[model samples]
Target: MEIPENYPKKYWHCHIEVDTGGKKNTSAIFNDLTIKELWQQVVSPWHTHRPFTVDGTIVRDYDKVQKIKITQTEHPQSYYAEQHNASMQRKGIADMATNRRLLPLSKGKDYTHEFLFADLTMNDNEQEKVVSNNKIFIVHGHDEQVKETTARFVEKLGLEAVILHEQANEGKTIIEKLEKHTDVGFSLVLLTPDDVGATVTDKENLKPRARQNVLLELGYMAGKLGRGKVCALKKGDVEIPSDLIGVLYVEIDAAGAWRLQVAKELKVAGLGVDLNNAI
Candidate 1:
């Protein structure tokens, strides 16, 4: 077999000889094989053919075996490669633990931990204390009327509305500011028809749409907070984004029916909302 130039220079060479009393020994030699590959290609097949007894019970259809012997020799290059790999694995694990401990609680959500460790353990009450449940992030576009009205309604529900631009810039970029403020438990996306666009082929047939920034923030909020915790308020003749098919979109009609819908969504998302206040 041709080996790639980057392949490990050393490997365990294995020789297996099986003697079933009736016949001559059957033997095979494999060169440049990893320990796992040696077991899978050679040892496992023999074990399957003649399974060892478990709890003094014989497996069905087991082959009668006399003697089976396996010999393995590790090349010097392979031994060094194994040692290097093991050391790197140990260092990687240590670095991951250190990084996890150094990351702030707000940024910890970005990392995925497969197993629970002592440093990462937190009770439900502790987690609730870290994340604010009463704050609602409002992702708005160019429509000041809709933005102000939505902010007012959110505040009227006895909850704090987090408006991005209203917060101090603090010498951070827009995305950085957004990341700092997205710790809220819920988000409200205002999809006002602030722009118009159409496919390249049908440039003349433009349709009203929300600003690109609004859609970008909408997606970001939906991902940060789950779709159930994010609600989109469509105002006027704005075209709904096709990608957000499963997300909840409430119509902001002139008669003010959207307030009740928003209040219901907030209540379902574990926010304290007074339905009567919405009406």
Candidate 2:
């Protein structure tokens, strides 16, 4: 069935995402009508009735005449994939809400959340002085002292740092948490002996080491921002993984020399570091 024009339908578009491994993993579209039709087609065979989720973001608007710019992104991590889909749905609804002006949708029956699309290309007349800021996410192991020392080191450097102690939960899986938070300005992975042995097995019962998760997180980010964005910090002389041979890292030593070394390296890489805070 053709979607009604006045009933809040938007332009349609599709794209494919590729990973650093050059694999085309997933494809998606940005039309409200097409998505609903597809959902019907999937359920019509089974005769079970329920709304479908490609992810959490749902397609509500469906327009056929309008054309949207389609950009294909390859090899995006889970974090990026969710963001990209949400952005498209928001944009589609925003067009209907504001007569083509890039504005938040009005709160009403047709739309749920208001979406604000800032024109990134349009330069603002007023610009504020930029302060160089860096946020480092610390993925810690079971070692409390190591976590605290790392936090203290980050505190010394004047950079905003938060040590994430991830415990397995039924709601938010460890993998999801890592993927969700790994895309910060920088990530500090404290690799412990226990962490190296940690592994999540698949249906086939094949188990990989736990350190593999950290590598996957780094691999996902490196695919987007390149190699320098991620760093592996050695807690106590753990052997580097074969996959991480190309990644640059610092070794932790007595008196916390590794912290100082990392701070220096970050600054050299154009990441602003507060030397006074590094005390």
Candidate 3:
């Protein structure tokens, strides 16, 4: 028997997701009804397929699922070993498949769904573009002038600019306030030497760096939106953490030429930017 490249070679495989919040969970795919019905018989709380409508944005439980590829190829030996052990594995898979009310941890239920052989129009890259085309977050500490300068540029370019400062504090921790805007396509971290710190052992020498909030926000933005979408603008000789040694940065000198550099990053982050357009 010849297996054509386009042939639907069926096997029980799970589409495990690698989420931005550092969680790995599975969403299964059952090829035929017999398998789905068989699992229903064994699993305590069984799930029958629901009517799914395919629109431009996948509507799963009233949320949009952001599609991502299965980055891992190898599965645990338990998922492969069959017979007695297979029963537990199947049950575990079933539980994961149905235990879905909301995934609030990673920004709460991004119905941006995808799985192997699942019917959907767009791919992962297209989803990224569509989702990231909205806003850009600017993280700063005690540099209102700099923030105002940057915000003006972002607005003139025709995109929404977000600042952690504008968010309602309401006694919320700094992190909680910042993460509320995690859906932004990109982040700008202003590294102005606003705060000075001394080493524990030597209190004599002072170091110039951004505030602790700025540093923490930069690291968080790098992890969530990814390093490529996060930019560090240096207005002074701020200490660059070793982990962010290779991240992109634009030095702001008196010449004020950082505009073009920042614009380039915005263009990639989904803004329809014209580099020639003077900022």
Candidate 4:
């Protein structure tokens, strides 16, 4: 069947049944149509078989579907799949959707009433592993004091601090290395003044800024792990990126108040943090 141009290209496995008096009901599976388009172009047309009786007493209309079981599959039809694949390839894997695996369909809990949908791609065990991640990526600049302090703080909370340079290169590029180590549940960005920069028209009026690589990794971490999972520790006076306005940044003060703030953020991000550890 030629799908409508406007309809979504998802493939659905639908189990439908048409009412027929005492005799056997007409049951069929339509595998190539989206639920919306299937209802409109196919099921709706069956309305002409109206006023049909089931079990010799109950009356029903074909349009008034008695039961609909729909399970969306992994890929669309070839034509739609090709189009989607081309678009995704152009955007690259970094921009691609999360990876998912389809599971075999199983019977629903109440076998008589409904069919159990496919199991979610990520099971409870996988989700628990992600949520229970104990490592925190540390995106730092040239400020050794700030970096060490932050790493120590994370360790105090019983969490591992993933410093990029400390990890094995294994012949991987910088970005590739970063990607490999981004399996952590949270990221701590150290924004320290390691460089000076100003607009093209104002060369002499340069201001303090974090290292270019530090800023790049900060953005990368923020994107990989959501903003809530990434926290920035601003040390001294550094030029903050305008694009990262909404990100949380705790100031590195002499009184060590930043530790408590960071610990709280970590707790909010679902990490196991003891606030007393910060003390």
Preferred candidate (lDDT higher): 2 or 4 = 4
Name model 4 segments beyond 4 Å from true. 1-70, 73-132
Estimate, for each residue in 98-210, the C-alpha lDDT of model 4 and write its tens digit. Answer: 22211111221121122223332444543544544688999999889888988998999999998989999999998889877876768999999999999999989999999
Q: Which candidate should be chosen as best, given TM-score against the real structure?
A: 4
Q: Candidate 3: which pairs clash?
A: 63-111, 64-110, 64-111, 64-112, 65-111, 65-112, 65-113, 66-112
TM-score, one value per model:
0.56, 0.45, 0.57, 0.59
- TM-score ranking of the models: 4, 3, 1, 2
Candidate with the larger lDDT of 1 and 2 = 1
Higher-lDDT candidate among 3 and 4?
Answer: 4
Q: Write the per-residue lDDT of candidate 2 for residues 1-279, one digit (tens) a residue.
A: 222234333222232122223344332333223323432432221112111233332221122112222221232233343554578788874323422211111111222111112222211211110121265677655666877788777766767674444434547766676554443456677765554342355345432232655556656655433456566677665656777778767777777677667887678655678655554
- Candidate 1 runs further than 4 Å off: 1-131
RMSD from true fold, candidate 3: 14.1
What local lDDT score does residue 198 receive in model 3, on the 0 to 100 scale? 81
User: Listing every candidate in turn, what is its Cα RMSD in Å to the true structure after a full C-alpha superposition?
Assistant: 20.7, 16.1, 14.1, 18.4
| Global lDDT of each candidate | 0.65, 0.46, 0.56, 0.67
Tens digits of per-residue lDDT, candidate 1, 1-279, equal 111234233353433344434467444334454545644443333322322222232222223332223333334334544555577688874333332211122121211121111143444543543456788999998989999999999999999899999999999999999988876768999999889999999999999999999999999887766687789999888998899877899999999999999999899777888999999
lDDT value, residue 205 of candidate 3:
84
User: What is the alpha-carbon lDDT for the whole of candidate 3?
Assistant: 0.56
Q: Per-residue lDDT for 182-206 in model 3, tens only? A: 6576788899889888889989888
